[model samples]
Target: MTRETVGIAMNGVTGRMGYRQHLLRSILAIRDQGGLALPDGRTVWPEPILVGRNAEKIEALATRHGLDKWTTSLDEALADPSVTVYFDAQVTQARVPAITRAIEAGKHIYTEKPTAETLDDAISLARIADAAGIKHGVVQDKLFLPGLLKLKRLVDSSFFGRILSVRGEFGYWVFEGDWQPAQRPSWNYRAEDGGGIILDMFPHWRYVLDHIIAPVRSVYAEARTDIPTRWDEQGREYKATADDAAYALFELEGGIVASLNSSWTTRVNREELVEFQIDGTHGSAVAGLRNCKAQHRAATPKPVWNPDIPATEDFLAQWQEVPDNAVMDNGFKVQWEMFLAHLVADAPYSHDLWAGARGVQLAELGAQSWREGRKVAVPELDRTGK
Candidate 1:
């Protein structure tokens, strides 16, 4: 069987998420695994051209990855007809312009989430891509996680007859730069750099709820700036203008209520950094990044209120663990393979630019809800081409 190659011009590979998730773990991993196999027997390999502003850094990464292509100029890469697809993982503020150029150049586009800093920009890009008839997608990596997959299976199989409510907790204590060097980039604390807990996470919450559970109709959010001051990479003090924490409630289509808390200031007490507990009429399930546990209505134990007496039943122990019944791979890689296949084979790709635009809209509305201290409605997004 002949192995066809798909050339991907990868921008913003110098950043952490771009470097680790998209470049190394996904695109490179796909190449390492001998490409994706099609039913017709042709295999497609992804050939990546690393694009960044730093020539030396790009060159270094290209060499490290044993790649033949590296470029400081984006236009140089864009001009080349061989580069069939363009992937962006740049900062939020820079996404729109680059994506527009890529779309204008007639390249299929895939980008990291919060597709644009503004919801309108995201929608405009979606419209452009629709008109251009180019394949487009946004990173919704959480959907492919093992735990979420298990949860999806349960929902699909009607194990949960009718989901009533959902509670999601996602957070970690980020170190203050003064004592321990901050794990996240210094730019994350500045609103000017397009950094906020709500912006970073609400899109994820939107898609997670819409896909796994039900479509969200409205959101009530409260965003907070917990740590006002933080040290930068140089140990210099800087003011954090962005919200570090956000608490939100989502109203889904089927009368399902979802509450989510996202914070960089919180400490972990659960099995994973992110966890979701969904309650249905027949059962309830709690899912983390890699594992899920469930308890059916039939298995529910009755426990009387006890403050004076010692604890009777071990409540947490009653939930049965869900077995890993399916093969799971790195979430980002799985999505990338799907996107590549979408480009070549014209395979079904639902997570397109319209989905990305809707994510942006939800984030925008979430901020609106936070600022106004009221619930904001989310109308159904018109998927222009799809």
Candidate 2:
């Protein structure tokens, strides 16, 4: 019935993910759509103050989007009494100090993950947020995807019967700047600059498996730098020190095993850039970004293996397509909406700083597992540092 504006200081929106997903698809989208509606029939409008390092880029972005409030200094943004929320989509290395300042300023925190490069830093943030009595959230966008939503529904409805295992494939070939300008930033390949496929992706896998399938108990991983050298955006050659690829096996709580491959050097051959196939005793399902397909035990094809004969069965067609029962919003937008509600309406939110710490924990453990050449146990972590 009534509408009110909430000031949100958005930092690091000049980057690709911050610009395309958070600023364009989420925050601005919500503004354009007449704000987010709460359960009590009230509308919560978002007024974003653009904050970044480059003045030209931030100003240009603000002007292009028809926005006015922007500043390069984090202190100036935090000093604004009207700014109640601080959202960070900054580079991984810069997140801690920025978020720490926001927490000290008494602003509710929302950030992109891996919350910090190390588990300790991430946990420290969580503790600090809790002590400050502020609501906080981390981006776990993939859990809200159409396909994953459908998979979650199936899991809830017992569609799979007894779950057995999960196999996931994620990645696409990133061009070297020499021939074609690389799609991703140059910092992604530099370990000193918080770059690596393991640190980048293991956090995502942590939440996905924990929420969708089961809690991750152990991890065994092998990380590699497939392309040791690549050119940067300026066409300057540099040694790629961070891992470009990682092959991993995770042991979940219910004895369910998940094996996943993450790579930036591999070309896409699957239906989507990322896909997860789950097998159970009674049925199996495959889910991509927006679509899912399933095969019941009774309908599964049985073909005898023969070395000499060509296969006649159209195996791909056997699985039935899962329908989109409802309209699905962009994953990033969905999470943004949820976080806003949680902040304003005191709605239950699970993807908090603690959850973010868990993601960082997984990534840290995954790296340790790779280094030690053993299955590393994932101990439970909480806000108390116990």
User: Pairing residues by index, what is the TM-score of model 1?
Assistant: 0.98
After TM-score superposition, the amount by which residue 279's alpha carbon in candidate 2 deviates from its true location, in angstroms, is 0.1
Off by over 4 Å in 1: 384-386
lDDT of 2 by residue, 1-386 (tens): 99867899999999999999999999999998999999899999999999999999999999999998999999999999889899999989999999999999999999999999998899899999999999999999999999999888888889899999999999999997898999999999999999999999999999999999999999999999999999998899999999999999999998999999999999999999999999999889999999999999999999899879888889999999989999999999999999999988888899999999999999999999999999999998866865
Which candidate has the top score in TM-score? 2
Q: What's the TM-score of each model vs. the native?
A: 0.98, 0.99
lDDT of 1: 0.92
Cα RMSD, each candidate: 1.3, 0.7
lDDT of 1 at 191: 94
